[model samples]
Target: MRVVMFGYQTWGHRTLQALLDSEHEVVLVVTHPRSDHAYEKIWSDSVADLAEKHGVPVLLRNRPGGVELLGALRDAEPDIIVANNWRTWLPSEIFDLPPHGTLNIHDSLLPTYAGFSPLIWALINGEPEVGVTAHRMDAELDMGDVLLQRSVAVGPHDTATDLFHRTVDLIGPLVTESLDLIASGRAVWTPQDRSRSSFFHKRALEDSRIDWTWPAEDLERFVRAQSDPYPNAFTHHRGERIRILSAAVSEGRYGGTPGRIFIREGEGIVIVTGAGARSGRLPGLVIKRVRTEDGTEHAATDYFRTMGGYLTPRP
Candidate 1:
């Protein structure tokens, strides 16, 4: 089958590589334009460069249906278009252009965690499982029939960067399997239950803010979800800001005070939260690593010490 692939970032790069290495012919590749340093620099290579290396034509279109982009896509005349986390929406014409219609590879299971930053959102919600789905594209965003789906456990120690990389690695061979099934016309697609569907927006700094009032377990999940590649969960420490990188539910708990910094045990500092103490259990977290707003990374305990002795002093 002749394939045209579209995506950006690490997810897109993996899909492009997979199709190129597969049995199908990739006629052209489409990706978002390099907006600026912020978006472009995160990725080591653009999808265009990879396509060029494989001698497959490449198209960078900020708007998938804009005049030039639409023309280029139509000219490529691919049998299938694989949407691997393509950020923008495609017009009906483009989605319907290819012979086998468009199939999208979403990071999350459809009808749930359907929008952007799915792995981040899953961790933020403290979900035990994270997975991907291949679906048939529709007019609505992520409102498509599911072709195939698989999930992996989100370990207690997992971070957004960890899950993001795992998902990208899974997408490579996993997608090739989907293509093989589709190529053989043995694809069994499933319709998503809209009743269980929820979409999320791209996370912003506001969303990453850690609420002191939230239970320590909730805060811990939030911290882990946003840490590292996804943007660290933040809080104001003695009027100066700090980002929480690695945290986990600690064993000890006293009373119901949230965000009260307790003694550091081993490699972390314990704090309280509701999610941490569910089912009549004492809930809290110990932060391991912390980064200050002033561009310094430090052990959480040491940073607490450097913060004008605020960790002690008693609130």
Candidate 2:
């Protein structure tokens, strides 16, 4: 099959590599230009770079519009269009151009987590499992019919980055199987249940702010969701910004204001959390590690030298 791929970043790079390794022919590749933003994560194995290495023509466009793009697709005459982590809206002119139609590889199970940072959102929401879904492309975002779905268990200690690596590994197999089904004319299409669907907007630095009012478990998940490669969940302390690297739910029950910093024996600096929805006992979270605005990383004990203050949203 002649595939015209639309993708960007690591997800795109991996998918393109899988397709190239397969019997399918990737005639044309469309990817976004390298972003200069310091916070944004540029792909280590970029789709554009991979395409060039394979001697496939590449187009760097955020939006797949204009006559040049349309003409390129027409000239290539793609049998099917495969998109993975493509950031822009693709008009029907391109998606509907191919004979086998377009297929998209999404990071989450369809009918849920349908937008940006799906793995992060799922982890923050405390989902038991995270999965990837291969589905038919439609005008609506991620509201397509399902072709293939695979899930990975989200362990209690699994961070968003951990889940991300696991999820990406599934993409290649999912894409290959989906394409095989499509080529064999045995592809099954399952319509998504709109009632069960949920969409999330793109995340920003502001979204990573740690809200102390949340339950201890939720806050712990928040920290894990944004750790390392992504922005760490943060809070303000005495006009200083502290990025929470990792945390865990403490076993003790403390009756105090939420977000108040307290030391626990062998547990590090523990912050009181909100009362459980049903348990009524106040929960707490043990801070494992943090990074201060001054760019110093510290263990909780060293960071909160004398901790008796509350962590507030404002300095």
Candidate 3:
């Protein structure tokens, strides 16, 4: 099959590599320009560079659907369009151009998480598993008919980075398998259940700010979700920003106001947490490690020498 690939970053890079390795020919590649956003910088393997190295035609665009881009796609005459981590919403003319239409590879099990930073969100919400979905693109964003879907179990202590590594491995095999099915006319596209669907917005630095009102378990998962290479979950202590590097739920339940620097338990410093903290039944968040603004990491016990202060949402 003659393929046109729309992708960006490592996800796109992986998808393009899969296409290149497969029997199909990648005629044209469309990818986003480099981004300065913190999250975008991580896992950023260059899709454009890989395409150029292989002598495939490449177009750099912040968004798709320009007249020149449209002309390029038409000239390339792709039998199918395969997209992964394409940042912008593709118009129908672009996605529906080829005979087989567009196949999008997303990082989550669709009809649930159908938007940006899915792994992080899923980990934070304590989903049982996280995976990738290969589906046919239609009018709605990520609300496409499924071609192939694969998932990995989210372990109790798994971080977002762990989930990323596991699920990314699925991209190559999933892309190739889905394409083979489509080319041979054995593809079974399943319609997404809109009733079970959910969409999320792009993550920003502010989204990592710690909200102590959440229960300790939720906060612990939140920290793991925003693990290193992404962004650390953070809080403000004594007018200084501190990122939570490692944390756990305290074994004992002792609470006052949320975010209060309470007592030490084992190797961590317990911070009173949850809206119902005053009842002293909810477990506090035991902060094990923290990073200062200057990039210095420290044990939470050493950082909080004297307790009884509050960790605020802002300094």
For candidate 2, write residues 243-308 as lDDT tens digits: 999788887776677778876646478888874423438668889889998778998888788979
TM-score of each: 0.89, 0.96, 0.99
- Which parts of model 1 are misplaced by more than 4 Å? 36-44, 272-282, 306-315
Give me the overall lDDT of model 2.
0.88
What's the C-alpha lDDT at position 153 in model 2? 99
lDDT of all predictions, in order shown?
A: 0.78, 0.88, 0.95
Model 2 poorest 10 in a row by lDDT: 36-45
Error of 3 at 239 (Å): 0.5
lDDT of 3 by residue, 1-315 (tens): 999999999999999999999999999999999999998999999999999999998999998857999999999999999999998899999999999999999999998999899999999999999999999998899999998899999999999999999999999999999999999999998999989999999999889999999999999999999988888999999899999999999999985999999999999999999999999999999999999999999999899999898999999
Which residue pairs come into collision in candidate 2?
A: none
Give the Cα error of residue 235 in candidate 1, in Å.
Answer: 0.9
Tell me the TM-score of model 3. Answer: 0.99
RMSD of each candidate relative to the true structure: 3.5, 1.8, 0.6
Best by TM-score: 3
